[model samples]
Target: MSAQDYAEISTLMQAYADGLYHADSKALRQVFHPRLAYVCATPGDELHLDLETYTARIDKRTPPSETGDARDDRVLEIKLATPQLAHVTASMALMGRTYLDLLTLQRTPEGWRIVTKVFSYVPMEKS
Candidate 1:
């Protein structure tokens, strides 16, 4: 992958972290594809949500930003299968949980956008 593509995707992931941290659905719309798929299949608590539904849920949550919570968002890895597609592994903290997200992104006409997100989370044990 070109350096530019890596940097762009890196920035996009950062935006994702910020979006969730602030619960800003408007900001999320800029990075996520309109028809993106969100899935979580952690056994009995499986979840499947489309882009609009996911964003709507974000809109309804109280933001960590408002709660003064520490933001622990990171991009663990990024792999580009082709010039137009990429896969990212990332982690973020939200609502007392740590989520690991496997994201698929596409280079759309409007630039890179997240097309799918398959994720899982676990409770953040108290230290």
Candidate 2:
């Protein structure tokens, strides 16, 4: 990938973090594809969320930034499998717990957008 490609992807990833942190649906929508598939494996069942459902959940939540909650987000790695396809791994702290997300991206005409996100939530130890 070219430097510009890397930069654009990085920016999109950053937007994802910031969007979630602030509960900004518009910002989140900008980075996610319209046909996004978000998957998560919980203890008892798995969750499969479409874009609309995800955004609806976001709309009902209070943002960490507004609640004075601490959040940490980091991009672990990004691998470009093809000119138009890439995978990114990221770590994020939310609600005092950690989560690891694997995001699949596709280079669309608009830009690079996240097409799929498979994530696992890590329970924090009691202090």
Question: Which ranges in model 1 have alpha carbons more than 4 Å from their true place?
Answer: none
Residue-level lDDT of model 2, residues 1-127, one tens digit each, is: 7898899999999999999999999999999999999999656658999999999999999998998877889999989999999999999997767889999999999999999999988777757
> Against the correct fold, how does model 2 do in TM-score?
0.95
Q: Which residue pairs show backbone clashes in model 2?
A: none
Over 4 Å off, model 2:
none
Whole-model lDDT values for every prediction:
0.91, 0.93
lDDT of the structure predicted as candidate 2? 0.93
**Residue by residue across 6-76, what tens digits does model 1's lDDT show?**
88998898888888999999999999999999999566779999988998899899999999887898899
